[model samples]
Target: MSATHARKKPFLRLATAAVAMVAALGMAACSGGASTSSSSSSSAQVGDRSPEQIKEAGEIVIGIFSDKAPFGYIDADGKPAGYDVVYGDRIAADLGVTAKYVPVDAAARTEVLASNKVDITLANFTVTPERAEKVDFANPYFKVSLGVVSPTSAEITDVSQLAGKTLIVTKGTTAEAYFEANHPEVKLQKYDQYSDAYQALEDGRGDAFSTDNTEVIAWAIQHPGFSVGIKSLGETSYIAAAVKKGNTALLDWLNNQLVELGQENFFHKDYEQTLAPVYGDAATPDDLVVEGGVDTTSTN
Candidate 1:
């Protein structure tokens, strides 16, 4: 009756919130770069803020999820809780500045960065060839692939089974884009929030839902009736911090921070505090973590 086999979950884990709401990101054509590798750009094409400029600002605005949980979301105490939010704080602390958390959806991650609305996006921003042209990504810090969640009753076993089926997905997410490009036959019902997408799946609005496999696995565990049947829809991807295109100073600083933090295994500790609660022992840091802006999955 379940979709994903719990014993063999894929890498990349899950969720988010809202602050200073802005316009939603419209689906646009993207140019590709390497996805989730240790690669990054040495320069930016716009929004090049000097280190002094960032320092003088006394705060670094970080765009993060305000709805998806474990990875990012508003906690019971009405504050940000999740993996990305944790790093946002650390990034500010490293700069001796206040961490300003700006809530963003999957789609807004790029627009905010390119528009200088936020200094960076730590909201599960995956690297892709199309996305690379829009922003400069630092080294990837997490690794994940795609997954599909469907009700047990649907019996959806794989992505290929989704042909002609309407799958609900969060707006501006890679899922929507991926399906649009590669699986044009699969109809997508895009929602602005993850809850809406999950709701759509439950309400019979769509045959299934898809996103980062890591997240759907956590969701399948949390909500009993649903299961992540499709473990991986595409290639493994890296999750990296993204800054405005041409902001090499900020990009370098973020990359250096990742390398320094990796020495302390800070991301591991972060997983223990954030993701472990949701995934329990199902996911280890090495299963999905990328350290020093590099893919350690092969070695670890």
Candidate 2:
């Protein structure tokens, strides 16, 4: 489809289809609204429990990306591993439960939490005011800015250079909204996953891919010839964990947990385990880690 036509109407349809995957899983799992379970625990339900209830259950299911690396992804052993997963492990441990992770994409992470498909989400979730209206966010845990990655051949050094080029972005990401509102001259090709957007860039189907500065930088370092040419392009933002709106008990517990974790430099440990091996000295802890709700970047 032409970019303009897709932008005018069909983009929402595609975004909905791509992110509302839990609904699809529900359809495949059982007859209408009937319950299902894993051997270890029951399926999650929306806002049905308090923190005490969740702790009693002995397991907390979390939604996280299985494709985006450094934050969340599948490891060589085919298990979820990354900064988010490592932090999730700590969350579960603090609550005296085991952590079970469900795959999520940027577009669907909030929906999964709202539907009770997961108790919490740590998929590099940014704390925008619009999202805060839909779900409650914990204290900010990481700071980020928009970044654009293009092949050195394209030489896209700044936002202005995007004038007539196509920039690939993930559905439901801030980058998609940024280009639409601020750089309407640039054509956008939105995909469901970051991996897909990056693949489009690799295949020469899109001139560049834009997302969180931290992520694209790590990706560029791991690959070759591509670099994060435009870092800090849009309003600075923060990433945080989220829960269903009004889930106060769980939200409060998470906030307290985050404070304690910060006191211990917990995210630094997570970075070492999940990020350092790939990033080496390319990124310092301060570059991505936000502690104790301290990163108060304006989301307005």
Best by lDDT: 2
TM per prediction: 0.83, 0.84
lDDT of 1 by residue, 1-300 (tens): 243344223212222122222222111101111121112222322245555565655656678777676787765445666899899889888888766667777887899887766778889988998899999999988999899989988758877898988988888878888898899989888888776787678788999999998888887877767878887878888899998888888888888888999899888899888888668766777888877777855655
- lDDT against the true structure, each candidate: 0.74, 0.76
lDDT per residue, candidate 2, 159-207, as tens digits? 8888898999999988888889899999999999776787788899988
- In terms of lDDT, the poorest run of 10 residues in model 1 is 25-34
Residue ranges of candidate 2 with Cα displaced over 4 Å: 1-47, 296-300
Residue 260 of model 1 has an lDDT of 98
